[model samples]
Target: MLILGAFNLFVGRLYLIPSESMEPTLNGCAGCDGDRIFVNKLAYLGDSSPHPGDVVVFRGPDSWNGSYTSQRSRNDVIRGIQNAASVVGIIAPDENTLVKRVVATGGQTVQCRAGDPGIMVNGKKVDDEFTEKPMSNPVDPATGSQACQGPYFGPVTVPQDNLWVMGDNRTNSLDSRGHMGDELQGTVPVENVVGRVEAIVLPFGRTGFVDNPDIQHN
Candidate 1:
């Protein structure tokens, strides 16, 4: 028991899906709850970074909030308890953590076309079949205003050691595309990544290894 607990604390951990941002890929959409996934915390232990198409959990920057909101605000004590539980994987961290898929990595240009099925990385179009919905430019949910008339964005270049990430349910996700004007042009630092989601281990019907789409560009 002690060994298992230690392993869960350091090597692998569990996370519960909380929103529909990832949709069909992760089961957190409206009318559907998220899945319980196993995160391989040790996947990027050394001088490595997440590859494009890798599903990862990371700390959202100040400009970004996590995929979903907590049911209700918790008092400081409760919040502290929740954080403790999250460390051991008993519950998902509801703070500034987000789950997204890598769209592009350092030195790559990523763009979304108004009429294209998926965004392009390094000029190579990636029409991911795993995506629950086609990619589209995100809109401001609070005011129902579109950032641009069309869901088209620039061929923004990812910075060194950073990653551009998105959600599977592109239409509803507030991902890198939504934060283009931010300091890092919406690219997240590699250091913020928690781990790569390896598989869905709960809910027998949906248990399986998560697929890593081939999004590499030569």
Candidate 2:
């Protein structure tokens, strides 16, 4: 078991989708059980980087709910077990390490507008056909007023070596768009990426290769 665990940790690992952040594309949404996915750690062993539309597993920044740091808040033995279990995909390394889809890579501009197929990258509309609902902000259902208002996020360019990521369930996901004011300005550094999700590995009914969206920059 240890050997298999180590191999998985260094080469490929499995992850259980614990939230609805990537719903409709990767499951784990409200009232639905999550999917287990295979993450290929060697995917970028040749110094490759994440591409737009690839679902990736990564260690989020400090401001991303302190997922890594939270371990420090746990009992030593429990934390140790969690870490060991993570080697074989028993649980996530921490709550902060997450799975999200890359929306824009370095040097690209991305924005979310108030309309159908709401996301645009590098001035080109992404073919977002996987989502069940059109992108819309949370609003007061009674009056239809936006629950919160601002500059409407992005229209900002991703910095070199950084990536703009989001969930397939756009409206409910707190992704790069929600982290705009952080130290990384809502973009995750390329170095933080762990690997790309290759396929669903559990619940036989949902096992399959994850589809990469057709993202164009015009």
Candidate topping TM-score: 2
Q: Which parts of model 1 are misplaced by more than 4 Å? A: 1-5, 66-80, 114-117, 133-150
lDDT of 2 at 188: 94
How do the residues 94-155 of candidate 1 rate in per-residue lDDT, one tens digit apiece?
66778999988999998765544447777677756676643444555443323222257778
Q: Write the per-residue lDDT of candidate 2 for residues 91-165, one digit (tens) a residue.
A: 656557788989889999988555424577876777666753544355443432231121255677999999999
Question: Candidate 1, clashing residue pairs?
Answer: 19-28, 20-28, 20-29
In order, the Cα lDDT scores of the candidates are 0.77, 0.76
The 10-residue segment of model 2 with minimum total lDDT is: 142-151
